[model samples]
Target: MKLLLIPDKFDGSLTSESFANAFVAGMKKSGVPFTSRYIKATDGGEGFLKVVGKYKPCISIEVISENPLRKPIRSYYLYNKEDNSAYIELAHASGLELLQYDELNPMLTTTYGTGIKINDAVEKGVKHIYIGLGTSATNDGGIGIANALGYIFLNDKGEVLPPIGSSLRLIKSIDDSHVSEKVKQVKFYTVHNVINPLFGKDGAAYVYAKYKGANDKVISDLNKGLIRLNKVVSDKYNVHYNDVPGAGAAGGAAFGLKSFLNAEFLGTIDFILKLSGLREILHKESFDYIITGEGKIDKQYLNSSLLQSVIGLGMEYGIPVIAICELLEISKEDLKEIGVFDVFDLKDEQKNLEYNMKDTAHLITAKTAEYFSDK
Candidate 1:
């Protein structure tokens, strides 16, 4: 049998590449007569650049930037000299992974570092830029980026306001006279992993701020700020930020880029798949089974275009798709309805969190061996 192993990162434990390696090792140990191919699947989040860099010939450039807390750090991006294009993963500079558990407050975090990365690419005279927006640690609605690009946000007193989430509601006007001319010359594309809107109950602050360490009060404040910022964007740029799909991604970074940088949004998985030629590979190669999973498997995965597209491809090719996830919240019937042949949940009754973390790879390998050995 020929099997394709494609999985997303297991959050804090393993990367997609690592997960694929573990799965391959298990398949080898199973003693099953099978040839396996591996591919890293990402939703334009943390591992986007690593997966893209695997197939694309690009130069890595490191630059100085700040983290969510405005601390100086070194970050990098991939540049394709042949196409005069740059690929940026937002998480590299302004990601939640850069922070500790105690420092995870979105109200204080900023995307200024992301802007610094973009400015670095722009200064290098790149003609096109593609940015992956995921795994962010801020809820500033792109104010920090705008600030870095020379757009000054002011309060009612006409004094410059700090570019942070809490300052969104204090912006009385925006000054664009000092905005970078180089930024206008480049075409920007934002790869969005989610489809949330800019404001309202399902919007940026309401749905995502909690993950960034917002309390009930902070969430409420952030929501109000998002609403006010939407109006400001409409008045200043004549763009209705709330009308755009995926505007809430990365805590309104999508909205901020669209309104200020004239960015066009694209689905993360589709863009990555196209860039990696995965669809063409699927069409050309014949495989009996396709395996995929992530840190968690829930109804939310069903809403993801990434998972949906994979399922569609499997159904079209008549290949059975199996999932092995750290957590499984969907039922067998639901899984079948979504074209998943089976699911393997990693949480064992006998294992605790610490044990699971330490033995995730081994457990996955052993389980895969046992399951296919029976087959």
Candidate 2:
């Protein structure tokens, strides 16, 4: 049998590469003869650079950046010399993982730290920048990044807003007079797999702010803020981005990138799949099963572009799809509807998360052997 492995990282446990390796080992141990294609992938949120570097020539450029609270931290981005392009993972500076649970409030958080990273690259003369936005902790729109690059947000009193979510509803106007010429010239791309709009029922604030630590009242206020910011942008620029498919991503950071930097958008899964030559492979080869997964299997996985993309490919090529994850939480009916023929999870019910994560490779190997032993 020929297997196509393009699994996602198992959070703290395995990268897609390592996941593929363990699965293959299981196949070998099961005495199943197989040929395989292993491609390392990311959603372009966390492990973006590592996947990009596998196919592109890039170097890590380290700099001092700020956390979502405006505190300083060390971070880095990938820079490709060939086209003077830079790939920045926004979570590196503004992700939820950077904050403690008590510090998770989005109202006080800012994307200013991510802006600092962008500004640093701009200062270094990079012409194109790709910002990966996901797992964010801020709901300030893009004002934080704009502030770092010389745009100022002001309240009705003409006092500069602090570039936080709490200030969103208070925004009376914007000051772009001091925005640098270089910042204006560079091309920007918001990279992720989000399709939500900027600010309404399904917009950034209402859908994502709560997860970023906002209560009902706070989510309401944050939504109002985003509304204000959109109105201000429309009045000033005679433009609208509030309804754009990806404008609501990263707590409206995608909105900011577009309204401020004139950014375009890219889907991480599509980008990685195309760049990895997987589509090209479809021209000459076929697979018995295309394997893919993330940390957990649930309803979100069913709606996800990652799993959907794999399923689409499997459907197009008449191949079945299988998945391996750290845990399985989706129903068999859901799997059947998605065209997944089989699923495997390596979770050790009696073991703690730490132990399971540490022993993931062994677990995956054993599980894989079990799944294919009869076949």
Candidate 3:
């Protein structure tokens, strides 16, 4: 039997590479005669630059950028000299991981730090800039980034507002007089795996703010701020950002880039699949089964469309696809109807989440071996 494995990180538990290794070990333990190949791929999230570096001849350009609270931190982006292209992962500058438990308030957070990285790349005369948007720590509608690129947000009194989530609702006007002329010449793309809208129940603020430490009132306020931002953006760009898909990505960073910088949106999975030469691989090889998974197989994962794409690939090749997630909350029937041949979860239900996470590698190995032992 031949298999191909492609998995995402199990959140805090295991990386995709480690997960694949453990699974392969399990297969070996089962004494199954199998040949397998694994890929370390990312959907333009944390490991995006690493994937880019694998495909492109690039160098890391380090720059001092700001954290979510406008504090200085060292960050870097992948710069390709051959095509003058740059790739940036947003979390490198303004991610939830950068904050302490007490510092997890989205109201005070800003994406200005990410903007600083973008500005650094822009200043280097890069013709193309691709930003991977995920795991952001703010809900400021990305005005913070605009601020860093010379766009100014002002209150009704014409006073400049600070670049924070709290400032989004108070803005009455935007100024681009001091914006760089070079900004208009560059091509920009916001890469993400979600298809959420700019502002509403499914939008950035309502769906993501709670994880960023927002209370109900704060979430509502942030949602209102996003609406206000959309209005302002629509007025200036003659584009209705709220109607756009994927505009809610990274706390409206996608919307901001499209509205402010004329950036296009690229789905993360498709972008990576093409760049990683997955199609080329498929043409040269055939696998009996394709194994793919993430940390959770819940509603969010259902909406992610990553698995769906993988399943589509399997269906195209008449190969069965199997999922091995940490927890599978969705109906097995639902997944099966959509081309998944099987689903296996790794959670040790007898134990608490802490133990399960701490020993995920073991659980994954045990489950894989047990499933194939009798086959």
Which stretches of model 3 miss by more than 4 angstroms?
A: 315-318
List the RMSD of every prediction in angstroms: 2.2, 2.3, 1.7
Model 2, range 1-375, lDDT digits (tens) per residue? 998888888877787888888889999999989999887777657777778788888999998999999888999998999999998998999999899999999999999999998998998999999898888999998889989999999999999989998999888999999988989779998877777888888888888888899999999999998999999999999889999887988899999999989999877766776668877887888888888877788764443346766776678789888887787887867788878877877789999988988999899899889889988
| Order by TM-score, highest first | 3, 1, 2
- Top-scoring candidate (TM-score): 3
Q: Return the lDDT, model 2, position 141.
A: 89
The lDDT per prediction is: 0.85, 0.86, 0.86
> Looking at model 2, which ten-residue stretch has the lowest summed lDDT?
300-309
In angstroms, the error of model 1 at 1 is 2.4
Model 3 lDDT tens row, 1-375: 899997778888898888999999999999989999887667556777887888788999999999998888999999989889999998888788899978998889999999999999999999999998888898888898899999999999999999899988898999999999988889999888767898889998888889899999999999999999988878877888776888888888888888899888887656766777877888999998898878888766665546866777788888898898877899899899988999998888789989988888898889999988876
Clashes of 1: 0
The TM-score, computed over Cα atoms with residue i paired to residue i, of candidate 3 is 0.95
Give the per-residue Cα lDDT of candidate 3 at 42. 72
Kindly give the stretch of ten consecutive residues in candidate 1 with the minimal lDDT sum. 300-309
Off by over 4 Å in 1: 29-31, 300-309, 312-319
Whichever of 1 and 3 has more TM-score, that candidate is: 3
